[model samples]
Target: MRRRTMGMLAAAAVAGLTVAGAPAAGAVPSAAGDAVTASVWRNVALTGTYTIRDDEGIFAAGTYCNGNVASEGWVNEVRTPSVWWETTCGGEIRVEKHVSAETDAGGGVMIYVTLRFYEGTNDTNTDLDAEYNFNRYVPA
Candidate 1:
Protein backbone atom coordinates (compact mmCIF):
# COMPACT_ATOMS: atom_id res chain seq x y z
CA MET A 1 0.00 0.00 0.00
CA ARG A 2 2.78 2.48 0.83
CA ARG A 3 4.61 1.71 -2.41
CA ARG A 4 1.44 2.27 -4.48
CA THR A 5 0.71 5.59 -2.74
CA MET A 6 4.32 6.77 -3.24
CA GLY A 7 4.15 5.79 -6.91
CA MET A 8 0.97 7.82 -7.41
CA LEU A 9 2.51 10.88 -5.72
CA ALA A 10 5.70 10.62 -7.79
CA ALA A 11 3.74 10.33 -11.01
CA ALA A 12 1.63 13.34 -10.10
CA ALA A 13 4.71 15.42 -9.29
CA VAL A 14 6.47 14.49 -12.52
CA ALA A 15 3.35 15.30 -14.57
CA GLY A 16 3.11 18.81 -12.93
CA LEU A 17 -0.34 18.06 -11.47
CA THR A 18 0.26 19.52 -8.06
CA VAL A 19 -2.37 21.22 -5.94
CA ALA A 20 -1.99 24.48 -8.01
CA GLY A 21 -3.33 24.88 -11.60
CA ALA A 22 -0.39 26.81 -13.15
CA PRO A 23 1.73 25.84 -16.17
CA ALA A 24 4.28 22.98 -16.12
CA ALA A 25 8.01 23.19 -16.73
CA GLY A 26 9.58 24.62 -19.87
CA ALA A 27 6.66 27.02 -20.27
CA VAL A 28 7.45 30.05 -22.49
CA PRO A 29 5.88 33.48 -21.99
CA SER A 30 4.26 35.43 -24.79
CA ALA A 31 5.98 38.48 -26.30
CA ALA A 32 2.97 40.11 -27.97
CA GLY A 33 3.68 43.54 -26.36
CA ASP A 34 7.00 44.27 -27.97
CA ALA A 35 7.41 47.22 -30.36
CA VAL A 36 9.84 48.02 -33.17
CA THR A 37 11.20 51.33 -34.47
CA ALA A 38 12.10 52.38 -37.99
CA SER A 39 15.64 52.92 -39.20
CA VAL A 40 17.11 56.34 -40.00
CA TRP A 41 17.18 57.91 -43.42
CA ARG A 42 20.44 58.41 -45.28
CA ASN A 43 21.83 59.77 -48.57
CA VAL A 44 24.94 58.64 -50.43
CA ALA A 45 26.71 59.25 -53.72
CA LEU A 46 28.86 56.82 -55.76
CA THR A 47 31.11 57.33 -58.75
CA GLY A 48 32.70 54.66 -60.93
CA THR A 49 33.07 53.33 -64.48
CA TYR A 50 29.81 53.61 -66.52
CA THR A 51 29.51 51.73 -69.73
CA ILE A 52 26.85 50.77 -72.31
CA ARG A 53 27.11 47.49 -74.17
CA ASP A 54 25.65 47.46 -77.68
CA ASP A 55 24.07 50.79 -78.63
CA GLU A 56 26.38 53.81 -78.50
CA GLY A 57 25.24 56.57 -76.15
CA ILE A 58 26.98 59.89 -75.40
CA PHE A 59 27.56 59.96 -71.62
CA ALA A 60 30.13 62.28 -70.08
CA ALA A 61 32.90 60.96 -67.87
CA GLY A 62 34.23 61.88 -64.37
CA THR A 63 30.96 63.11 -62.85
CA TYR A 64 29.19 62.03 -59.70
CA CYS A 65 25.64 62.34 -58.32
CA ASN A 66 23.92 61.90 -54.99
CA GLY A 67 21.07 59.52 -54.14
CA ASN A 68 18.29 60.57 -51.77
CA VAL A 69 16.78 57.59 -49.96
CA ALA A 70 13.85 57.36 -47.58
CA SER A 71 11.69 54.58 -46.20
CA GLU A 72 10.05 54.25 -49.59
CA GLY A 73 12.47 54.71 -52.47
CA TRP A 74 15.43 56.71 -53.86
CA VAL A 75 16.16 58.94 -56.83
CA ASN A 76 19.37 59.50 -58.88
CA GLU A 77 20.07 62.40 -61.21
CA VAL A 78 23.14 63.64 -63.09
CA ARG A 79 24.25 66.33 -65.56
CA THR A 80 27.10 65.57 -67.92
CA PRO A 81 29.52 68.46 -68.45
CA SER A 82 29.89 67.68 -72.16
CA VAL A 83 28.65 64.86 -74.34
CA TRP A 84 31.56 62.84 -75.73
CA TRP A 85 31.60 60.28 -78.53
CA GLU A 86 28.63 57.92 -78.27
CA THR A 87 29.82 56.18 -75.11
CA THR A 88 28.07 54.71 -72.07
CA CYS A 89 28.71 55.77 -68.47
CA GLY A 90 26.80 55.24 -65.18
CA GLY A 91 26.97 53.70 -61.71
CA GLU A 92 24.81 51.18 -59.78
CA ILE A 93 23.59 51.16 -56.20
CA ARG A 94 23.47 47.88 -54.25
CA VAL A 95 22.63 47.18 -50.62
CA GLU A 96 24.25 44.71 -48.23
CA LYS A 97 22.53 44.27 -44.91
CA HIS A 98 23.37 42.38 -41.72
CA VAL A 99 22.18 42.15 -38.13
CA SER A 100 24.10 42.71 -34.88
CA ALA A 101 23.50 41.38 -31.42
CA GLU A 102 24.17 44.73 -29.71
CA THR A 103 22.24 47.92 -30.39
CA ASP A 104 21.12 46.65 -33.80
CA ALA A 105 23.66 48.66 -35.75
CA GLY A 106 22.06 46.99 -38.82
CA GLY A 107 25.51 46.67 -40.35
CA GLY A 108 26.92 48.94 -43.04
CA VAL A 109 25.71 48.92 -46.63
CA MET A 110 27.56 48.93 -49.97
CA ILE A 111 26.03 50.80 -52.92
CA TYR A 112 27.09 50.66 -56.56
CA VAL A 113 25.69 53.10 -59.13
CA THR A 114 25.91 53.37 -62.90
CA LEU A 115 24.83 56.44 -64.90
CA ARG A 116 24.49 56.75 -68.67
CA PHE A 117 23.74 59.63 -71.03
CA TYR A 118 22.19 59.20 -74.46
CA GLU A 119 21.09 61.68 -77.16
CA GLY A 120 18.19 61.38 -79.56
CA THR A 121 15.91 63.45 -81.76
CA ASN A 122 12.13 63.35 -82.28
CA ASP A 123 12.37 62.81 -85.99
CA THR A 124 9.05 61.17 -86.98
CA ASN A 125 10.04 60.19 -90.51
CA THR A 126 13.24 58.38 -89.53
CA ASP A 127 13.89 55.84 -86.72
CA LEU A 128 14.23 57.72 -83.42
CA ASP A 129 16.20 56.34 -80.47
CA ALA A 130 14.31 54.62 -77.67
CA GLU A 131 15.33 53.60 -74.15
CA TYR A 132 13.98 50.53 -72.34
CA ASN A 133 14.46 48.16 -69.41
CA PHE A 134 14.80 50.81 -66.72
CA ASN A 135 14.66 49.23 -63.24
CA ARG A 136 13.64 51.31 -60.23
CA TYR A 137 13.57 49.88 -56.70
CA VAL A 138 11.05 50.81 -54.02
CA PRO A 139 10.92 49.89 -50.35
CA ALA A 140 8.16 47.68 -49.01
Candidate 2:
Protein backbone atom coordinates (compact mmCIF):
# COMPACT_ATOMS: atom_id res chain seq x y z
CA MET A 1 0.00 0.00 0.00
CA ARG A 2 2.88 2.41 0.70
CA ARG A 3 4.48 1.80 -2.69
CA ARG A 4 1.15 2.26 -4.48
CA THR A 5 0.54 5.57 -2.73
CA MET A 6 3.97 6.86 -3.72
CA GLY A 7 3.39 5.96 -7.36
CA MET A 8 0.03 7.74 -7.30
CA LEU A 9 1.61 10.91 -5.89
CA ALA A 10 4.30 10.87 -8.59
CA ALA A 11 1.70 10.49 -11.30
CA ALA A 12 -0.32 13.37 -9.90
CA ALA A 13 2.75 15.62 -9.84
CA VAL A 14 3.56 14.83 -13.48
CA ALA A 15 -0.02 15.47 -14.48
CA GLY A 16 -0.06 18.82 -12.69
CA LEU A 17 3.12 19.90 -14.42
CA THR A 18 1.78 18.93 -17.80
CA VAL A 19 -1.44 20.83 -17.27
CA ALA A 20 0.44 23.92 -16.13
CA GLY A 21 2.71 23.86 -19.17
CA ALA A 22 0.02 23.43 -21.76
CA PRO A 23 -1.10 26.41 -23.80
CA ALA A 24 -4.48 27.80 -22.97
CA ALA A 25 -7.36 26.92 -25.23
CA GLY A 26 -8.43 29.52 -27.80
CA ALA A 27 -5.03 31.19 -27.68
CA VAL A 28 -4.57 33.50 -30.63
CA PRO A 29 -1.88 32.90 -33.22
CA SER A 30 0.76 35.59 -33.42
CA ALA A 31 3.20 36.81 -36.04
CA ALA A 32 6.00 39.33 -35.93
CA GLY A 33 4.99 42.41 -37.89
CA ASP A 34 7.67 45.07 -37.66
CA ALA A 35 10.71 46.00 -35.60
CA VAL A 36 12.64 49.21 -35.09
CA THR A 37 15.92 50.07 -33.41
CA ALA A 38 16.97 53.30 -31.83
CA SER A 39 19.84 54.15 -29.54
CA VAL A 40 20.80 50.57 -28.71
CA TRP A 41 17.18 49.71 -28.02
CA ARG A 42 14.74 47.74 -30.11
CA ASN A 43 10.98 47.65 -30.17
CA VAL A 44 8.80 45.07 -31.88
CA ALA A 45 5.19 44.98 -32.94
CA LEU A 46 3.00 41.99 -33.62
CA THR A 47 -0.10 41.76 -35.79
CA GLY A 48 -2.62 38.97 -35.98
CA THR A 49 -6.25 38.29 -36.62
CA TYR A 50 -8.51 36.65 -34.08
CA THR A 51 -9.26 33.93 -36.59
CA ILE A 52 -8.73 33.43 -40.28
CA ARG A 53 -12.44 33.77 -40.98
CA ASP A 54 -13.14 36.72 -38.71
CA ASP A 55 -12.72 40.46 -39.02
CA GLU A 56 -11.38 40.91 -35.50
CA GLY A 57 -7.68 41.62 -35.17
CA ILE A 58 -4.97 41.93 -32.52
CA PHE A 59 -1.86 44.13 -32.22
CA ALA A 60 0.98 44.17 -29.76
CA ALA A 61 3.92 46.49 -29.06
CA GLY A 62 6.83 45.91 -26.76
CA THR A 63 10.36 46.92 -25.97
CA TYR A 64 13.24 44.48 -26.24
CA CYS A 65 14.85 45.07 -22.86
CA ASN A 66 14.19 46.62 -19.50
CA GLY A 67 14.83 50.28 -18.58
CA ASN A 68 13.87 52.85 -21.19
CA VAL A 69 10.83 54.79 -22.32
CA ALA A 70 8.65 53.54 -25.14
CA SER A 71 5.30 54.36 -26.64
CA GLU A 72 3.02 52.98 -29.29
CA GLY A 73 0.52 54.72 -31.54
CA TRP A 74 -2.11 52.47 -33.00
CA VAL A 75 -4.89 53.25 -35.46
CA ASN A 76 -7.45 50.67 -36.33
CA GLU A 77 -9.89 50.80 -39.26
CA VAL A 78 -8.15 53.98 -40.25
CA ARG A 79 -9.79 57.35 -39.40
CA THR A 80 -12.16 55.56 -37.02
CA PRO A 81 -10.38 55.33 -33.69
CA SER A 82 -6.82 55.91 -32.58
CA VAL A 83 -5.11 54.91 -29.36
CA TRP A 84 -1.81 55.69 -27.73
CA TRP A 85 -0.35 52.88 -25.64
CA GLU A 86 2.76 52.86 -23.50
CA THR A 87 4.85 50.23 -21.77
CA THR A 88 7.39 50.38 -18.96
CA CYS A 89 10.10 49.70 -21.55
CA GLY A 90 10.05 45.99 -20.74
CA GLY A 91 6.68 44.42 -21.17
CA GLU A 92 4.09 44.57 -23.93
CA ILE A 93 0.70 46.09 -24.66
CA ARG A 94 -1.89 44.29 -26.74
CA VAL A 95 -4.99 45.71 -28.40
CA GLU A 96 -7.96 44.12 -30.08
CA LYS A 97 -10.39 45.68 -32.55
CA HIS A 98 -13.22 44.58 -34.71
CA VAL A 99 -13.56 45.73 -38.28
CA SER A 100 -16.85 46.89 -39.62
CA ALA A 101 -18.75 44.22 -41.50
CA GLU A 102 -20.40 46.53 -44.01
CA THR A 103 -17.87 45.55 -46.64
CA ASP A 104 -18.42 41.88 -46.09
CA ALA A 105 -21.45 41.93 -48.37
CA GLY A 106 -19.22 43.25 -51.13
CA GLY A 107 -17.13 40.03 -50.94
CA GLY A 108 -14.39 41.16 -48.55
CA VAL A 109 -13.46 43.69 -45.89
CA MET A 110 -10.56 46.07 -45.82
CA ILE A 111 -8.72 46.78 -42.56
CA TYR A 112 -6.16 49.49 -42.05
CA VAL A 113 -3.70 49.24 -39.20
CA THR A 114 -0.98 51.68 -38.30
CA LEU A 115 1.64 51.13 -35.61
CA ARG A 116 4.14 53.76 -34.61
CA PHE A 117 6.93 53.72 -32.06
CA TYR A 118 8.05 56.68 -30.03
CA GLU A 119 11.09 57.23 -27.88
CA GLY A 120 9.22 58.40 -24.81
CA THR A 121 6.18 57.31 -22.88
CA ASN A 122 4.05 59.86 -24.67
CA ASP A 123 3.61 59.73 -28.41
CA THR A 124 5.01 62.76 -30.17
CA ASN A 125 5.67 63.23 -33.85
CA THR A 126 9.12 64.60 -33.15
CA ASP A 127 10.09 61.57 -31.06
CA LEU A 128 8.80 59.02 -33.53
CA ASP A 129 11.18 56.14 -34.06
CA ALA A 130 9.38 54.17 -36.76
CA GLU A 131 6.04 53.72 -38.38
CA TYR A 132 4.44 50.64 -39.91
CA ASN A 133 1.24 50.52 -41.90
CA PHE A 134 -0.77 47.45 -42.91
CA ASN A 135 -3.74 47.03 -45.18
CA ARG A 136 -5.38 43.65 -44.78
CA TYR A 137 -8.34 42.17 -46.57
CA VAL A 138 -10.65 39.59 -45.12
CA PRO A 139 -12.89 37.61 -47.41
CA ALA A 140 -16.57 37.13 -46.74
Candidate 3:
Protein backbone atom coordinates (compact mmCIF):
# COMPACT_ATOMS: atom_id res chain seq x y z
CA MET A 1 0.00 0.00 0.00
CA ARG A 2 2.78 2.46 0.82
CA ARG A 3 4.54 1.74 -2.45
CA ARG A 4 1.32 2.23 -4.44
CA THR A 5 0.67 5.63 -2.76
CA MET A 6 4.22 6.80 -3.49
CA GLY A 7 3.89 5.85 -7.19
CA MET A 8 0.56 7.67 -7.46
CA LEU A 9 2.03 10.82 -5.89
CA ALA A 10 4.97 10.75 -8.28
CA ALA A 11 2.68 10.34 -11.28
CA ALA A 12 0.47 13.21 -10.14
CA ALA A 13 3.49 15.47 -9.65
CA VAL A 14 4.74 14.66 -13.13
CA ALA A 15 1.37 15.38 -14.66
CA GLY A 16 1.12 18.66 -12.77
CA LEU A 17 4.49 19.73 -14.03
CA THR A 18 3.61 18.83 -17.59
CA VAL A 19 0.42 20.85 -17.46
CA ALA A 20 2.13 23.80 -15.78
CA GLY A 21 4.92 23.91 -18.29
CA ALA A 22 2.60 23.83 -21.26
CA PRO A 23 1.48 27.10 -22.86
CA ALA A 24 -2.16 28.05 -22.86
CA ALA A 25 -4.19 27.13 -25.88
CA GLY A 26 -4.28 29.69 -28.74
CA ALA A 27 -1.58 31.75 -27.05
CA VAL A 28 1.15 33.25 -29.16
CA PRO A 29 4.75 33.32 -28.06
CA SER A 30 6.50 36.68 -28.11
CA ALA A 31 9.85 38.23 -27.24
CA ALA A 32 8.57 40.57 -24.57
CA GLY A 33 7.91 43.45 -27.05
CA ASP A 34 11.44 43.68 -28.37
CA ALA A 35 12.41 45.29 -31.70
CA VAL A 36 11.70 43.22 -34.78
CA THR A 37 14.76 41.29 -35.85
CA ALA A 38 13.31 39.78 -39.00
CA SER A 39 13.47 41.09 -42.57
CA VAL A 40 10.34 42.67 -44.07
CA TRP A 41 9.30 44.05 -47.48
CA ARG A 42 8.09 47.56 -48.26
CA ASN A 43 6.75 49.33 -51.38
CA VAL A 44 6.58 53.04 -52.16
CA ALA A 45 5.55 55.26 -55.05
CA LEU A 46 7.75 58.22 -55.93
CA THR A 47 6.22 61.44 -57.22
CA GLY A 48 8.35 64.29 -55.88
CA THR A 49 11.29 64.81 -53.54
CA TYR A 50 11.41 64.09 -49.82
CA THR A 51 13.49 62.62 -47.03
CA ILE A 52 12.69 59.76 -44.71
CA ARG A 53 14.42 59.55 -41.34
CA ASP A 54 13.57 56.11 -40.16
CA ASP A 55 14.69 55.52 -36.58
CA GLU A 56 13.42 51.95 -36.53
CA GLY A 57 15.54 51.01 -39.55
CA ILE A 58 12.98 48.50 -40.68
CA PHE A 59 13.11 49.52 -44.33
CA ALA A 60 16.44 47.82 -44.87
CA ALA A 61 15.18 45.39 -47.49
CA GLY A 62 15.16 48.10 -50.19
CA THR A 63 12.35 49.58 -52.28
CA TYR A 64 10.26 48.29 -55.13
CA CYS A 65 8.88 50.72 -57.68
CA ASN A 66 6.19 49.87 -60.18
CA GLY A 67 4.12 51.69 -62.77
CA ASN A 68 5.70 54.37 -65.00
CA VAL A 69 8.04 56.53 -62.94
CA ALA A 70 11.66 57.49 -62.27
CA SER A 71 13.36 57.79 -58.92
CA GLU A 72 16.67 58.88 -57.41
CA GLY A 73 17.56 58.43 -53.80
CA TRP A 74 20.35 58.17 -51.27
CA VAL A 75 20.32 56.03 -48.19
CA ASN A 76 22.30 56.98 -45.08
CA GLU A 77 22.96 53.96 -42.96
CA VAL A 78 23.57 55.18 -39.47
CA ARG A 79 25.71 52.19 -38.63
CA THR A 80 27.79 52.62 -41.78
CA PRO A 81 27.54 55.40 -44.37
CA SER A 82 25.41 56.82 -47.17
CA VAL A 83 24.87 55.21 -50.58
CA TRP A 84 23.40 56.74 -53.76
CA TRP A 85 20.82 54.75 -55.69
CA GLU A 86 18.30 55.30 -58.48
CA THR A 87 15.86 53.46 -60.72
CA THR A 88 13.96 54.19 -63.90
CA CYS A 89 10.39 53.25 -64.75
CA GLY A 90 9.58 49.56 -64.35
CA GLY A 91 12.87 49.00 -62.56
CA GLU A 92 14.13 48.08 -59.11
CA ILE A 93 17.00 49.22 -56.90
CA ARG A 94 18.58 47.49 -53.97
CA VAL A 95 19.27 49.34 -50.72
CA GLU A 96 20.45 46.32 -48.79
CA LYS A 97 21.05 46.86 -45.07
CA HIS A 98 20.56 45.34 -41.65
CA VAL A 99 19.34 46.72 -38.36
CA SER A 100 20.60 45.88 -34.88
CA ALA A 101 21.46 47.38 -31.54
CA GLU A 102 24.25 49.31 -33.19
CA THR A 103 22.28 50.63 -36.19
CA ASP A 104 19.38 51.71 -33.99
CA ALA A 105 21.65 53.43 -31.53
CA GLY A 106 21.52 57.14 -32.42
CA GLY A 107 19.55 58.95 -35.15
CA GLY A 108 18.87 55.68 -37.00
CA VAL A 109 18.79 55.62 -40.82
CA MET A 110 17.76 58.16 -43.45
CA ILE A 111 16.78 58.07 -47.13
CA TYR A 112 16.58 61.14 -49.36
CA VAL A 113 14.37 60.51 -52.36
CA THR A 114 13.06 62.16 -55.54
CA LEU A 115 10.39 60.67 -57.76
CA ARG A 116 9.01 61.90 -61.05
CA PHE A 117 6.47 60.53 -63.51
CA TYR A 118 7.34 61.35 -67.06
CA GLU A 119 5.75 60.52 -70.40
CA GLY A 120 8.40 57.94 -71.25
CA THR A 121 11.72 56.63 -69.98
CA ASN A 122 13.43 59.85 -71.00
CA ASP A 123 13.10 62.49 -68.27
CA THR A 124 14.27 65.31 -70.52
CA ASN A 125 11.87 64.58 -73.36
CA THR A 126 8.67 65.10 -71.35
CA ASP A 127 7.73 67.51 -68.64
CA LEU A 128 7.01 66.18 -65.13
CA ASP A 129 3.29 65.42 -64.72
CA ALA A 130 3.19 64.46 -61.05
CA GLU A 131 5.26 64.81 -57.85
CA TYR A 132 4.75 63.20 -54.42
CA ASN A 133 6.53 62.14 -51.25
CA PHE A 134 6.04 59.35 -48.72
CA ASN A 135 7.30 58.47 -45.26
CA ARG A 136 6.58 55.30 -43.31
CA TYR A 137 7.39 54.12 -39.80
CA VAL A 138 7.10 50.66 -38.31
CA PRO A 139 6.22 50.00 -34.70
CA ALA A 140 8.65 48.18 -32.48
Candidate 4:
Protein backbone atom coordinates (compact mmCIF):
# COMPACT_ATOMS: atom_id res chain seq x y z
CA MET A 1 0.00 0.00 0.00
CA ARG A 2 2.85 2.42 0.80
CA ARG A 3 4.57 1.81 -2.53
CA ARG A 4 1.28 2.28 -4.41
CA THR A 5 0.61 5.60 -2.68
CA MET A 6 4.10 6.90 -3.56
CA GLY A 7 3.61 5.97 -7.21
CA MET A 8 0.29 7.78 -7.33
CA LEU A 9 1.80 10.90 -5.84
CA ALA A 10 4.58 10.92 -8.41
CA ALA A 11 2.10 10.62 -11.21
CA ALA A 12 0.07 13.46 -9.84
CA ALA A 13 3.14 15.67 -9.55
CA VAL A 14 4.14 15.02 -13.14
CA ALA A 15 0.63 15.70 -14.34
CA GLY A 16 0.51 18.98 -12.48
CA LEU A 17 3.80 20.10 -13.98
CA THR A 18 2.64 19.33 -17.49
CA VAL A 19 -0.58 21.20 -17.00
CA ALA A 20 1.13 24.20 -15.48
CA GLY A 21 3.90 24.37 -18.09
CA ALA A 22 1.64 24.40 -21.12
CA PRO A 23 0.45 27.66 -22.59
CA ALA A 24 -3.22 28.54 -22.28
CA ALA A 25 -5.03 27.52 -25.47
CA GLY A 26 -5.39 30.37 -27.97
CA ALA A 27 -3.16 32.59 -25.94
CA VAL A 28 -1.00 35.07 -27.84
CA PRO A 29 2.39 33.36 -28.05
CA SER A 30 4.56 36.45 -28.03
CA ALA A 31 4.49 40.24 -27.76
CA ALA A 32 4.80 40.59 -31.53
CA GLY A 33 1.93 38.20 -32.19
CA ASP A 34 -0.27 40.08 -29.76
CA ALA A 35 0.76 43.39 -31.28
CA VAL A 36 -0.37 42.50 -34.79
CA THR A 37 -2.35 39.42 -35.64
CA ALA A 38 -2.65 38.52 -39.32
CA SER A 39 -6.38 38.25 -38.84
CA VAL A 40 -6.62 41.98 -38.09
CA TRP A 41 -5.54 43.08 -41.58
CA ARG A 42 -7.12 40.56 -43.88
CA ASN A 43 -6.50 41.58 -47.52
CA VAL A 44 -6.05 45.26 -46.67
CA ALA A 45 -3.76 47.44 -48.75
CA LEU A 46 -0.83 49.39 -47.29
CA THR A 47 -2.81 52.48 -48.26
CA GLY A 48 -6.15 51.28 -46.93
CA THR A 49 -5.94 49.85 -43.41
CA TYR A 50 -3.33 48.93 -40.84
CA THR A 51 -3.35 48.32 -37.11
CA ILE A 52 -0.94 47.97 -34.24
CA ARG A 53 -1.59 46.86 -30.70
CA ASP A 54 0.35 46.62 -27.48
CA ASP A 55 0.09 44.63 -24.30
CA GLU A 56 -2.47 47.15 -23.13
CA GLY A 57 -4.52 46.37 -26.27
CA ILE A 58 -4.92 48.16 -29.60
CA PHE A 59 -2.73 51.25 -29.77
CA ALA A 60 -3.41 52.44 -33.35
CA ALA A 61 -5.39 51.85 -36.53
CA GLY A 62 -5.62 53.82 -39.76
CA THR A 63 -4.88 54.30 -43.44
CA TYR A 64 -1.71 55.38 -45.26
CA CYS A 65 -0.54 56.14 -48.81
CA ASN A 66 2.52 57.50 -50.57
CA GLY A 67 0.25 59.85 -52.45
CA ASN A 68 -0.87 61.44 -49.21
CA VAL A 69 2.49 63.10 -48.76
CA ALA A 70 3.24 66.66 -47.72
CA SER A 71 4.23 69.52 -49.97
CA GLU A 72 7.22 71.77 -49.20
CA GLY A 73 5.10 74.39 -47.43
CA TRP A 74 2.15 72.55 -45.91
CA VAL A 75 1.39 70.02 -43.17
CA ASN A 76 0.09 66.81 -44.68
CA GLU A 77 -3.19 65.69 -43.21
CA VAL A 78 -2.64 62.01 -42.43
CA ARG A 79 -4.50 60.39 -39.56
CA THR A 80 -3.96 57.19 -37.66
CA PRO A 81 -6.73 56.34 -35.21
CA SER A 82 -5.48 54.57 -32.15
CA VAL A 83 -7.87 54.47 -29.22
CA TRP A 84 -5.21 53.42 -26.71
CA TRP A 85 -1.91 54.40 -28.29
CA GLU A 86 -1.61 57.79 -26.70
CA THR A 87 -4.15 60.25 -25.32
CA THR A 88 -6.40 59.78 -28.38
CA CYS A 89 -7.75 62.28 -30.85
CA GLY A 90 -7.96 59.14 -32.87
CA GLY A 91 -4.20 59.77 -32.96
CA GLU A 92 -2.00 61.08 -35.80
CA ILE A 93 0.93 60.07 -38.04
CA ARG A 94 4.12 61.67 -39.33
CA VAL A 95 6.29 59.71 -41.75
CA GLU A 96 9.81 60.90 -42.00
CA LYS A 97 11.86 61.25 -45.16
CA HIS A 98 12.41 57.85 -46.70
CA VAL A 99 15.87 56.35 -46.27
CA SER A 100 16.82 55.40 -49.81
CA ALA A 101 20.39 54.20 -49.36
CA GLU A 102 19.10 50.71 -48.54
CA THR A 103 16.96 50.35 -51.63
CA ASP A 104 17.78 48.14 -54.60
CA ALA A 105 16.51 47.80 -58.16
CA GLY A 106 13.33 46.30 -56.77
CA GLY A 107 12.83 49.38 -54.58
CA GLY A 108 12.45 46.96 -51.71
CA VAL A 109 14.25 48.13 -48.65
CA MET A 110 13.80 47.33 -45.01
CA ILE A 111 13.61 50.24 -42.65
CA TYR A 112 12.93 50.83 -39.01
CA VAL A 113 10.62 53.76 -39.51
CA THR A 114 9.41 55.57 -36.45
CA LEU A 115 5.81 56.72 -36.17
CA ARG A 116 4.04 58.78 -33.54
CA PHE A 117 0.51 58.37 -32.26
CA TYR A 118 -0.65 61.20 -30.08
CA GLU A 119 -3.62 61.35 -27.76
CA GLY A 120 -4.75 64.80 -28.80
CA THR A 121 -3.43 67.76 -30.74
CA ASN A 122 -2.16 69.16 -27.46
CA ASP A 123 -0.64 65.91 -26.22
CA THR A 124 3.02 65.05 -26.40
CA ASN A 125 4.13 62.53 -29.03
CA THR A 126 4.14 58.80 -28.35
CA ASP A 127 6.35 56.43 -30.34
CA LEU A 128 4.24 53.81 -32.10
CA ASP A 129 7.00 51.94 -33.89
CA ALA A 130 7.11 48.18 -33.26
CA GLU A 131 9.46 46.94 -30.62
CA TYR A 132 10.34 43.79 -32.52
CA ASN A 133 11.34 42.99 -36.12
CA PHE A 134 8.11 44.37 -37.57
CA ASN A 135 9.26 44.15 -41.17
CA ARG A 136 7.88 40.64 -41.26
CA TYR A 137 4.63 41.77 -39.70
CA VAL A 138 3.87 44.06 -42.62
CA PRO A 139 1.67 42.50 -45.27
CA ALA A 140 2.95 42.24 -48.83
Per-model lDDT: 0.24, 0.29, 0.26, 0.24
Query: lDDT tens digits, residues 9-58, model 1?
Result: 22332233111111111222234545543342223222222222222224
- Tens-digit per-residue lDDT, 58-123, candidate 3: 442233233322222222222222222233422211111121111122323232222333322342
Q: TM-score ranking from best to worst?
A: 2, 3, 4, 1
- The alpha-carbon root-mean-square deviation between model 3 and the true structure, to one decimal in Å, is 27.6
Q: Using Cα atoms with residue i matched to residue i, what is each candidate's TM-score against the true structure?
A: 0.20, 0.31, 0.24, 0.21
Off by over 4 Å in 4: 1-46, 50-101, 105-107, 120-133, 136-140
- Arranged by lDDT with the best first, the candidates are 2, 3, 4, 1
> What are the runs in model 3 whose C-alpha is more than 4 Å off?
1-107, 120-123, 136-140
RMSD of each candidate relative to the true structure: 29.8, 22.1, 27.6, 23.3
When 1 and 4 are scored with TM-score, the better candidate is: 4
Worst 10 residues of 3 by lDDT: 17-26
Q: Supply the TM-score for candidate 1.
A: 0.20
lDDT-superior candidate, 2 or 4: 2
TM-score of 2: 0.31
Measured by TM-score, the strongest candidate is 2
Q: Candidate 4, residues 29-134: lDDT per residue as tens digits? A: 3456556322111121121112222122245333222222221110011122222111222234322221111222222222222223322232245543322111
